[model samples]
Target: MKLSIERAALLRAVARAQSVVERRNTIPILANVLIEAEGDEIKFRATDLDIEVVDNAPAKVERAGSSTVNAVTFHEIVRKLPDGALVSLTDDGASGRLNVEAGRSSFALATLPRQDFPVMATSEYDSTFTAPAPVLRRLFDKSKFAISTEETRYYLNGVYMHVADAEGRQVLRCVATDGHRLARIDAELPEGAEGMPGVIVPRKAVGELRKLLEDDEMKIEVSVSETKIRFATPEITLTSKVIDGTFPDYSRVIPQGNSRKLEVDASDFARAVDRVATVSSERSRAVKMQLDEDRLILSVNAPDAGNAEEELVVAYADEKLEIGFNAKYLLEIASQVDRENAVFLFNSSGDPTLMREGDDTSAVYVVMPMRV
Candidate 1:
């Protein structure tokens, strides 16, 4: 394979491709990226057996061929080259090496046979639809924070994407929970998406999808099947296998009858919780919230490490209520609120608390209380 590509274009493609390659590899070829140069463009493909990413970049192709090289080493070499320099890659298929040259710097990396790389098999998608980048971004960004890190409950380690009935109309919804807190976000369902089967997108795949959603004006093509989900754009395509388990019923976890209401500035509430949590124990960073008529006080009491408290004037007309919650959970839930005021609906000191952005039902959060 012989091709010349600009440094900027080559760096962008290799950076994304290397991210999909796992650092520790039991199979030798799994750590390398397959490079194919043909038809005035070069394609970089990398996979970790479960997830695969292909990136295309325009280049000047002299001989149409393919080769495989270390993904991390290739990326680092291209990243250190001077801007605007032209990079050339050549493989003779005899020396077992891929030559990389840019200006005064030259490096030869060991190459593996392209036939050894495992490419993910294609699937017949059950449903395919297009949605705006911003719409898809909002659905995943707000809910991914609540994804579980525990490995035993593999079903809860991803965000659930499916069509849900909100009121009377069908909408696209994404929900994530970790047994401590939950995030549910909804968007208007796009055309041809009504028949799509619900799938649990793994946490690693969700992080990779965020890179494709940065363009505000671009539209993303999404394809879903029983076991795989694919997101594609003009320059990049990401394919991954979905979690092979059933997601638990989450509707019952969201409280519906919380009556007491308290409205407070989201930024102020988050900051006060952060400040008071400094004195609490690292194991259980609990902050107690004491709510009265038109007033809210946040306090943290640690017998060994002293105590801290902060008072904030809020809008609460209901009866008195006191609740305790983990400070980290409170901060994450409050940050999801984009609006000025965050509305909190409390059932009691023990029941789960519901929070939303100033009466907006599109995005809701639930956090379980902790005993102080």
Candidate 2:
């Protein structure tokens, strides 16, 4: 294939595909990007067995053909070329080499046959829908922090996306948990999603989809089947295999009857927990919170080291209570509360506690307690 493309356009196309190709895939073909030129368009495709991304950009097509080149090396070379320079890609079938030239810098990247590429077979998708970029963004952003790292429960390693009822209204929801903390978020249901199959998109897909959803107004077309899922924008399409496992029923962990409530400024609480946890050793850093009436004191005590306590005036009027939680967990969950205050509901010191945005019900988080 022979094609000439603007450096900026070339970088944009190859960057997406290269990001999908892992640096250390076991198969050689999986590390290369398939470049095809035809009808004034150049397409960059790359896959790592599970996820494949294709990018199409406008280019000057001198010859109509296809070739594969190392994704990372090509991306690096294209990145180094001066802004707005012209980049040409040329390939010869017999030599198995693709030449990339820009300005005085030129390199020949080894090529593999494009026929080796594994494309996802088309499926009669159970459902297809479109969602505003911000809606999808909020759905993933609020829940991804709680995705499990445990490899055994692979289903919990991704944000669980499905349709559910939230306060008598059909809502698109995303839930994730690691047995310690759980996050559940709801967005207005989009059309054509009544029969959608629940898919546990792997962690990498969540990340890649997030980068593409940065433009708030950009609408995304999502297609889902039992084995694979695809998300597309105007120029890019990403398809990946869903984890073939059952997601544990996450509803039980969401506490319903927790009565004790503590309302504190989210930023202030996160800051207090962060400052107190600084003294404790990494492995056993726990922050003890002593709550009484409207006054709260957060303190961390380590036997060999010193201690720290910070007092914050909050909205609490319950019986005296003392609870301890992992400082890391507290800081992370607290940071997620973007609004001014975070409302935490406790049911005894051992059972899981609940957190919500002030009094809002659309988003809620549950966190397990750790022994002090």
Q: Judged by lDDT, which candidate is best? A: 1
lDDT per residue (tens digit) for residues 1-372 in model 1:
899999999999999888999999989999999999999899999999889999999999999999999999999999999999999999989999999999999999999998998899999999999999999999999999999999999998899999999999999999999999999999999999999999999999999999999999999999999999999999999999999999989999999999999999999999888899899777367889999999999999989899999999999999998899988999999988899999999999999999999989999999999986
Error of 1 at 140 (Å): 0.7
Clash pairs, model 2 backbone: none
- Residue range with the least summed lDDT across 10 consecutive positions in model 1: 278-287
Q: TM-score of every model?
A: 0.99, 0.97
lDDT of 2 by residue, 1-372 (tens): 788999999999899889989888888889889898999899898888888899999999989999988889999998989998999889878888998888888888888888997775776888999989899988888888889999987878898888888878888888889998899988889999878888888889998888789887799999999988899998889998888888888888898999999999999899889898888887348789999999999999987789899999999999999999988888878987878999999989999999988878888999998887
Q: lDDT score, residue 83, model 1?
A: 94
Total clashing pairs for each candidate? 0, 0
